[model samples]
Target: MLDLVVLVSGGGTNLQAIIDAIDNGTITNARIRAVISNNQNAYALERARRHGIEAVCVSPKEYADRELFNQAFLDTVDAYQPGLIVLAGFLVVIPPAMIQKYEKKIINIHPSLIPSFCGTGYYGLKVHEAALTRGVKITGATVHYVDEGTDTGPILLQKAVEVREGDTPQELQRRVMEEAEWVILPEAIQLIANGRKEA
Candidate 1:
């Protein structure tokens, strides 16, 4: 089985999608080993618990410095021996050491198609707002391997969602999650899982 360690920051809609996909057999030969969150009160923890998956929190606030927190985070993740690490709306910038250790084994689901409204200071509704501000009609979501640079990893899957007229950022975000993020994230996971099995 392909073991996954999913990281989340806020409400875990993407995490929910993964759980549902696994339960429904859309993503086979894989199971979530644990769900880790930076926020102690993240609802994602509850979601993981509901599914009987191990849930943990390794907050930066608990540590004295970023270095300490990063080590704790890395140690926590490594303990799970995850085959794949999935960033499902995880807002924290990944630690460089962890990235180096995991390499292409880590992946993220970005809200935008990437290379636009991505990189620094672009996340969540901000991406949708920027797309609206730029008047782009074709905004979407991307699933990519996690690299050292932000959203600069090799692309795995992308699905476009229409930016409708008079669509608010919240509305656009919702649609993108439903149409693109939800679909592609699970698909990407399955692709990776199947590839490992084949190999």
Candidate 2:
């Protein structure tokens, strides 16, 4: 079975989805090894602990530099020997070294369609706000490989959600997250796991 290290910074809805998938055999060959968060108060950590999985926090404020933070993050994740690194709502900019080390093994679920409202400063509610402001008719979530660039990795799977004329950012985010949890994340993980088997 593949082991996953999930990183999150807020409410762990995506993390919860992964756990549910594992429990229900949707992700047959995987188990969550650990969950890491930058924020001590993040609910994701609590969820991990509830599931008897190791949950840890590595605050960037504790490190003097970005490289140091990245090294520390790498060390923390390394202890679990994770086959895959899943970024749910993790808000940190990963350094090049860690990205190179993990390469295509790291995957992220972005709140918006790629090559659009994605990049630095485009996360959480901001992504939905941008899409709504642009008067887009369709917006959705993307699951992609994580690279050095901001959300500019190879796409694995994407699911679209229609944007209603009177929809607020919060409403759009709600629908997008629902699609993310039920469709995008599970398909992405299955793609990687199946690819590993092929290799």
Candidate 3:
């Protein structure tokens, strides 16, 4: 089985989706080895523990500097021997060493369609707000390999959701999560689990 280690930094709604998919067999040939979070209080850890999956925290606060934290984080993840590292909503800029070590073995689910409201200073609700401000008729989510550059990896899957009239950023964010992120993230995982890189 492919051992997965999911990294999260928030409520972990996407992590929950992956767990549900695994439970229902939507994803096969793989299993979550652990859930790692940078936030000590992240609810994702609770979700993982509830499901009997190992949950760990490698917070930067525990270390002396960024370099030390980065090393500790990488070592913690490596200890799990994960075949795939999924970044569901991890906010930390991945250390360059980690990216170099894992390469295409790491994947991330971005809130926007990418090359648009992505890159630095764009994350979470900021993406939806930018999309709304730009008046884009369609906004979506993307799953891609994690590269050194922000959201500049090989695209795996993308699903677009329409921008509804008079929609608030919060509302649009919810819709995109439900319509696009929830669907394509798991689909990407399934594709990789089955030994296919494209879908």
Name the regions of candidate 3 deviating beyond 4 angstroms. none
Task: Report clashes for each candidate as comma-separated counts.
Answer: 0, 0, 0
Q: Candidate 2: TM-score?
A: 0.95
Q: Pairing residues by index, what is the TM-score of model 3?
A: 0.98
TM-score: the better of candidates 2 and 3: 3
Best-fitting candidate, scored by lDDT? 1
Listed in order, each prediction's TM-score against the native is 0.98, 0.95, 0.98
Report clash pairs, candidate 3.
Answer: none
Candidate 2: how large is its RMSD? Answer: 1.6
The digit string of per-residue lDDT tens for model 1 on 1-199 reads: 8999999999999999999999999999899999999998999999999999999999999999999999999999999999999999999989999999998899999989887789988998899999999999899999999889989998888899999999999999999999999999999999999994221
Model 3 per-residue lDDT tens digits across residues 1-199 = 7889999999999999999999999999889999999999999999999999999999999999999999999999999988899999999999999998998899999988877898989899999999999999999999999889989999888889999999999999999999999999888899888988732
Q: Is candidate 1 or candidate 2 better by TM-score?
A: 1
Q: What local lDDT score does residue 34 receive in model 2, on the 0 to 100 scale?
A: 94
- Model 1: clashing residue pairs? none
| All-Cα superposition RMSD per candidate | 1.4, 1.6, 1.2
Better of 1 and 3 by lDDT: 1
